[model samples]
Target: MQQIYLDNASTTFPKPQAVADAVYQYITHAGTNISRGTCATTTEDLVFATREQLCRFFGGEDSKNVVFTKNITESLNIIIKGLLHSGDHVLVTAMEHNAVMRPLQQIGTELTTDNAPTDAITFSRIPCDADGALRLDALPQLVRPNTKAIIMTHASNVCGTLQPLAAIGSFCQKHNLKFIVDSAQSAGVVPINMQEMHIDALAFTGHKGLLAPQGIGGFVLLESMIDEITPLIVGGTGSLSHTEHPPRFMPDKFEAGTLNLPGIAGLHASLSWLQQQGIDKIRTHELTLTQQFLDGLQQSEAQNLLRIVGKRNCRERIGVVSISTDITDIAELAFILADRYAIATRVGLHCAPNAHKTLETYPTGTLRFSFGWHNTAEEVNIALQALKEVLAHGL
Candidate 1:
């Protein structure tokens, strides 16, 4: 059976040929550890070139401000752990993944803005509408005297609802609060400009929308935030070998130890591919596929059996569509789709239990079918037919 993979939100598959070729070329021909070897020209040049590519891709003003890590989780850790002090207050949406919530829980007292929080280190969860759109009007009331930053995901990984970043950035500007975005779901599919969005920092993964391999992700920070954020990981940066302490430079301050050259090479190539295709084109393709799937669900008889988790309109979301059903075990349904129908999907909280709770699907997760740039309308139709069959089977 021909398999249909629809889990792009987790990680994009069938990466561009150039991306795989770049990774293979690095691993086979130029496998030197950057900043450590005596002959580091090739490795250093490739790494820096990848950095430049990412800088332009994210609309970062300075190339040196791009700091790479293992993934978006690590990037968020670096930002949250490095920037938040003992008494700093934070604002986050109800749709945050564990990447943002776990770190904040570790260092700050997280609370919901609907209720009053104590004067100690505090963080508030902003509410979202039934359609998963954030209640931006509540932001002004949510702000406290000690609120230091607003950390939010650009789009919900569970339901794919696109947040109003520009308006939130304006709110942050007015409140004199830092705007830190987690772009794991929107980096490549959505256009993000740091300067235009007034973003202080952005954390992103290369594996998902960027269409690169895993094990490589990074953050973009403005020049002003360089001094404010402390280094989470401190070690040799190849620049200050003589010094015992970690370097205080832009990228070096956050990036420590050996870099993921192979993964970076893949990302470099993927950036080139994205540049050639243009982000708008890729976004339109994905959105069109999403609309096709949504329309199919609405028209199909299985529509009564499945309830879409977020906004019905495709324009309000990315390519992620999560559906919850009256069936008790959605995981079993997912297994039947995979084992019998050869249709792959993600079924669970999607690492965002908070989002599921906000959507009122807690304790039971949705069957998420996320699309990609390469996914076709025909695949969506096949999945829809498969879903109808599953429902006919009394599931």
Candidate 2:
């Protein structure tokens, strides 16, 4: 059986050939650490080149401002833990993942068991509509004088609803608050411009929409934020091994220890591929597939067997679709699809229980089927047919 993978939102599958080749080339031939003037291969040059590539891909003004980390979760931790102080407050949406929430909980006024946080960071949650759109009207009311930043996800990992970044940026500007974005779900799948969007910092992952290998992601921040954020991890940066103190420079201030050269190589190649393909073309293809799936689900909604969990239409949404059904347990359905139909999907809260609550699918979450640049219309049709068959058998 040909297994159909529909979990791009978790981590993209079937990465482009160039990405894999780049990783292989780095591991096989240039299997050395990156330090300037250290290796004849100029491995540092390749690393810096990838930094520049990522800077350009994400609309960062300078390559030096790009800092690498293990993944978006770590990037977010660096931002949340390094920047916000004892009196600082932040605003986040209801759809944020554990990457953001877990850190915020540990830092803020919330009570936690393991860690005692010195930073008394407080946060407010901006509610979302039934369709998973942020309630921007309620945004103004939630702002406190202590609100230092707004950390928002560009796209919901669960429902794929695209947040209003520009409008939110405008709001942040008016409120004199920093706009920090988590672009894990949107980095390569959608266009993001830091300057145009007035973003102070943006975190991204390579394994998802960027179509690169896992274990490498980073954040780009404006030069002004350099002084505001403290480095989470402090160690050997190669540039400043002389003194025990971490480097005060842009990326060195945030990045410590050895970098993931293999993942960087893969990301570098993926960025080039995305540039050549153009995100507009890629986004259109994914949207076309999403629209196809939504149309089929909508036509069958009258049966009361399954219902979409987020925006009914295709507008302002990614290719991630969450569907909840009364026919059978979503877990069982997912297993049947995988075992019998050879269709793989993600089922559960998707690490965003609040998002499920907003979509009215909490406690019992939805079965999510996400599409990628490689997925075809045929795959969408197959998924729809498989869903019908599974639900029919349950009935």
Among the numbered candidates, top TM-score falls to 1
Local distance difference test scores for all models: 0.89, 0.88
TM-score of each: 0.97, 0.96
lDDT of 1 at 301: 28
Q: For candidate 2, give the lDDT.
A: 0.88
**Which candidate gets the maximum lDDT versus the true structure?**
1
Per-residue CA lDDT of model 2 for 343-384, tens digit only, reads 889999988878888888989988999999999988899998
Candidate 1 has its poorest 10 consecutive residues by lDDT at 111-120
- Tens digits of per-residue lDDT for model 1 on 325-362? 88547998899999988888999999998898899999
How does candidate 1 fare on TM-score?
0.97
Give the Cα error of residue 79 in candidate 1, in Å. Answer: 0.5
